[model samples]
Target: MMAGEKNPASCYLDERTFRLCCRLFLQHSETIQDGWSWEQIKGTDEGFMKKTVLIPVQSSVMHKQHGCFMQAENMDHLTDDIQSNVEDETAGVQAVCEIHAVLRYEYHVLYSCSYQIPVLYFRASTLDGNPLSLEEVWSNVHPNYRQRLQQGPWDTLTQQVMCVTS
Candidate 1:
């Protein structure tokens, strides 16, 4: 049986049988990893204004497969900076505030891809879940790349040659 599968009611009636079935399923599933859990970095008082809460989960696969560890402290620092700015007198409170921060872990076996690339993507918003602008988001990026990212042809690739084959 697969994780999240709906088993027959009769099979679940016996506690021992149900436990056995769960154990079997867990032992066979590729997605199941030990010690995976979520932790909240910020409280409601922080500028998060969204109804949806954010939680960060530590992922072993991300480290083992991608050769990269998702730094929880980096995300925490970003949230903390935003919170401090809000509390400061110079930066007045906005109509929307950050309410939650979450991290998600996903495991997949892609046969077509040769390398496992660990990509870190972040979304920031008002409590209502509306996304912040690039400027707002880049405020969290390292200063050296901030200016370059804003005005560079980062996404555009130069074509080295055009080829014609007979």
Candidate 2:
């Protein structure tokens, strides 16, 4: 691109422009080692976003996943020895927030030929690389996005990820 040339303003972004934008952003970030990387569609010039981020899971949430919780007094010693440090709940206990595990999010941004728009797609997994299903992903969506996803784009982002996959 020439110095006088401007960034593409249209919805359909060419691969060259996409590469340029990625380079610009990566250069700005100045991180030689980063989670964001480029991936080709194999035997084609088409490319898309791929980013992985680690998110901390609170002990409370992990606890809920492990089993049901009753009154603190009724709580047993529970030899499970989970991430929680709330040893004594007999007299109304307080617990510090602890990270049970770190979740890895694989994100993607691709131009959809069918929808004629850029679509977002992402999935979360454990550090061990166990991919979470779409149902698991939807179950954890924030309430705010629940309303927004009823419309297009967002609904397509998570569900219609066929933009690139298909």
Candidate 3:
């Protein structure tokens, strides 16, 4: 094996080994700054378990006027839209309210016997635990990941192995 890589296919994920894996992984993450808290969770699989990590939402931002996050180029279009809705007297400038929202993420990793690899299932939610829609989740993922997701299912086996937090 190489540094920072785990050979998942080389090791069988039985109940005992899965428990140990979760413990060791959790222990290692605890030493890192701002590490997301993880816990061992029981799975429906006869011989395997899962590791779940929960990241809580930290804050909510209120925008001065449409409470939205606008890219530099989009601001010009937004200004035009705002001006069109108002009288010519205020055509050049207008005030809008913007709101920026953040979400919490929950991830579960389990060994899939059918695929012979580990699968990571994650979801984004509000502070109260209401889940985000598929479209919203797709939008939230980094653009680089969008293509990987479109490739197919079970592709996450490799994707999970490649994911690293900076």
Candidate 4:
């Protein structure tokens, strides 16, 4: 309910409502922005998948803009390694890519069904998407999120891509 809070469980919308909201938000963003776009694709579940990208303008500081993909997964969808590696106790997962930053970060949120909380499973990397040593990633991430990233796996989900001008 509060704006700009760090907790995902605090999100009032449930999964179905959240997906619908995402679609609607994407539609409005397209009308108001020159370089933002998103589309829904079929999902493993009855829900939908969404991929969004925001390209920067000529005056922007970052030269490259990378597309980010986010999707949710139920407990049954997780791999054995991921299931075991994630320390958080949760019933669902949300995965996201962060290639737009100077360092790439790939993280998953595990939603605790009972508590309605979201726990982060995260890892970061160098600009080329090469896996950083745990120490390296530890130093790069903010102090607040360091614990989550440190507790999670070492793989990154995003790869560098050239900006598309057209």
Q: Which structure among the candidates has the greatest TM-score?
A: 2
Write one digit per residue (lDDT tens) for candidate 3, span 15-48: 4565567667767766652343444346743432
lDDT of 2 by residue, 36-141 (tens): 6667899988888777655444334334443323334322332222213222222221221122344456788777666556567777865555555565555556
Query: Every model's Cα RMSD, please?
Result: 19.1, 11.2, 14.8, 17.9
Q: Provide the lowest-lDDT 10-residue window in model 2.
A: 89-98
lDDT, model 3:
0.47
Flag regions of model 1 displaced more than 4 Å. Answer: 1-115, 139-144, 151-166
| Model 4 lDDT tens row, 1-166 | 5886677645654666555655676678568642233333366443332322211111122222323222223222333423342333122222211322233344434344565443344445433455445544445446787677557535432233346697
What TM-score, over all chains together, does every model reach? 0.24, 0.49, 0.46, 0.30
Q: What clash count goes with each model?
A: 14, 0, 11, 0
Query: Candidates sorted by TM-score, descending order?
Result: 2, 3, 4, 1
lDDT of each: 0.36, 0.52, 0.47, 0.40
Q: How does candidate 2 fare on TM-score?
A: 0.49
Give the range of the ten consecutive residues with the poorest summed lDDT in model 4.
52-61
**True-structure lDDT of candidate 2:** 0.52
Q: Arrange candidates by lDDT, highest first: which order?
A: 2, 3, 4, 1
In model 3, the runs with Cα more than 4 Å from the true position are: 1-11, 38-99, 110-119, 153-166
Candidate 2 ranges with C-alpha deviation above 4 Å = 1-9, 31-34, 63-99, 133-166
TM-score of 3: 0.46
